[model samples]
Target chain A: MLLIALALLQTTPVAVAAAEEPIAPYAQSNANAGAKPFESDGMWRAFHGREGVDRIVDGLVERSLVDPRISDTFKGHDMVRLRRVLKEQFCHLLGGGCAYSGRTMKDSHKDMGLQTADMGALVENLQAEMNEEGVPFFAQNRLLAKLAPMKRDVVER
Target chain B: MRIFLIMLAALVASPAAASDWRGDGKLVLTDGITTVEGAAGGGIATWAVIAGNETERGVGATAHASHVALPDFDLEAYGGAVGLFDRVELSYTRQSFDTRGLGAALGLGRGFTFQQDVFGAKVKLFGDAVWDQDRVLPQVSIGVQHKRANRGAVIAAVGGADDQGTDYYVSATKLFLAQSLLVSGTVRLTEANQLGLLGHGGDKGDDHTAQFEGSAAVLLTRKLAVGGEFRTKPDRLSFAQEDDAYDVFAAWSVHRHVTLTAAYADLGDIATVKNQRGLFVQLQAGF
Candidate 1:
């Protein structure tokens, strides 16, 4: 029964950007997500599949936009595309069966001049959003474990 | 002159925290709480964590007051530490041990107190313990603690060889986030007896010997962790056997800037008093 519900969640429509600004062309691959997916679907079910990943991404991006420490970093960026790709990236990393259509972490963060503090602030926001979704602390850490290494790529400064 | 010194210190510190001064950027408790010896770590064992809320680009500080109440003795430590760029750490701690009524039994006057000071420095070599989850390497650091004991007469009477000595150590620490676990191991070379509270070296052995501090913690939440630590000691003075120490501890970050630690410590034996178990508590304010 739980598996059936999780499968149904995968089909639930997640919000996509109506339009995205075109940028310099780059190759897209699941590899661009910067982390490999979990081997078992247990992680996907733990995340409540697509619906949970969508909410977490939307919530994280929304929180980061207003967060004083990291707000300046998000200004003038394509938030719509950011939200969509974040969902994809999260879904893929969580083994939710979604293809990541984003650029590599280093390339996308190019010239952003992000500092370690910015990455820390963003991580704090992500933790908050994940907590708001009632994810177990252990499961939250599993996801964070995957995302943590990306700090090297995402924070260039 | 005082104002000039303060300004000079501020000027020296400002260059490292290039990230706009407010160094409260690292995740909560990642900076670690102050150990009894004034280094960032668990209750008793010094870890590889830098003592600050800063990460790679900021300067921060930590201060702590710790107390341990043993059956026949009581110990107190109060100190502060400065963290530079989350890379280098300097700390100072003053430790005082009160013998209570037991002092008179050893032919010393009542309430004989032993006081000592520990000045410590640690430098991180490499690896990000908290961040490098994809890798197997743990964060490593090397440190030195120069301890000075004040009761020279008592130390000499007990056959202790030196009143002051230096301890050298290297530590490795890692957080297995996926497992909600944190582990640390430290190897120290020292001739200190009873953590240098009884002075350094001894008639039995004046040479430095290798000791170990090992600990493991379960990360319960973002701000709470419970752990256990075991530390080996050098049995320097034959007058009284110096034994190992162990503790089970819980550390909670009540706020981002304040932490409280409580522990049940078995210090084994001290000054011929056997089974020196007690309650250990610490309050830390940082960054």
Candidate 2:
């Protein structure tokens, strides 16, 4: 009787494992499928309503225009269109109800001769802008963390 | 020495003219405290991070004073370092080792002192400890230190072959920003006895041997870090058994220009003194 009970216990876990394993992936896929698009969140609304992101984009453009290290990269570019595209890109990244229609990070920065120092300057400017916009440090870090993966695509030199 | 002074002058002069210096400005606690040998690292190890606030385009310098008091001995060191373009570091340090009880035991009278000057240079090989977060690579550097001891007569009497020698090392440092952790490892090829205070190459052997040093730290805040370090030493002198050194240290970056560090160090045996342990304190100021 003891042996039979032991055998049942061993088989029961296997049965339970089989039953539980499939549901996890299924639930994960369902969650991914049901994820809301970026435009519906309160955080996104707050960010866009205050024009916080626009201010940040404006700050970046202004700094880059004068920065000796990176000013030449923007000499021939269209400033007004670039500003709009940057706003759209930042808004999309921050979960605002917008989609980015501009070039991918790699394509946009390709052949730009961007060095690590240039990237560092851009980040420094963005951080200053975030501080000026009264964004909390944690929030600033969150945005940086999200954007950090783009370094591989953006840095060519 | 004249070149070092000129470099120091350059370091002190540059920050005054360039007020817009950027490029991370030395990540918090990533610039390890200056070591006794005048390298940027923990108590006894050399880390891969560059010495000062200098980034890719600017220059920075730091001056440090350190004191270590043991049961039978005491050590005092003063030094300064300059970093250029965050790529190369040049440092000069002078150390005074006071053999109190051990000197008397050796019949050399009490409070005998051994002094040495160390000139060091380090070059960054690759990677950035602070910003290369998305990857597993750590910052790596290679360094060399030329040491010349002052008490050549005493050193020669104690079985040392030379009063001067050089040590070479390679170091790697990594930081996990999310976890607030920093780690570093160094391998040195050295023949120094008592860090070249008692001089280099002894009766036991004269060939340089590889030694290991490592450090791990957890950041308590943006500017404070508490860590421990372990450094293995070569036992080249037959008269005394050299043992590994260890320290538990706390470093605080009080401001952009100053950092204070304190530690409890166990330097093992020095000149037949067993289990020599004591307090270590250092102050660093830089641009």
**DockQ winner among the candidates?**
1
* Clashing pairs in model 2, backbone N/Cα/C closer than 3 A: A39-A97
Q: Candidate 1 on B110-197: residue-level lDDT in tens? A: 8999999888999999999898999989999999999999999899999999999999999999999899899999999999999898
Instruction: Estimate the TM-score for candidate 2.
Output: 0.72
TM-score of 1: 0.93
| Clash pairs for candidate 1 | none
lDDT of 2 by residue, B1-287 (tens): 67557756876787675665543355555678899999988878899988877677667777899999999889999888888778999999999998876788878888888999999999999987877766679999999999999999988988998999999999999877645678999999999998999888999999899999999998765568999999998888888899999999999999867899999999998788789999999999876
Query: What lDDT tens digits, residue by residue, belong to model 2 across residues A1-157?
Result: 9589546544543455433212112121211211223344544544544267876787788878998767887876666656766777777656775656566677667788765557766776787777777775545555555455466677774
Candidates in order have lDDT scores of 0.86, 0.78
Candidate 2 chain B: worst 10 consecutive residues by lDDT? B20-29
The fraction of correct interface contacts reproduced by each prediction comes to: 0.75, 0.04
B184: Cα error in model 1, Å: 0.6
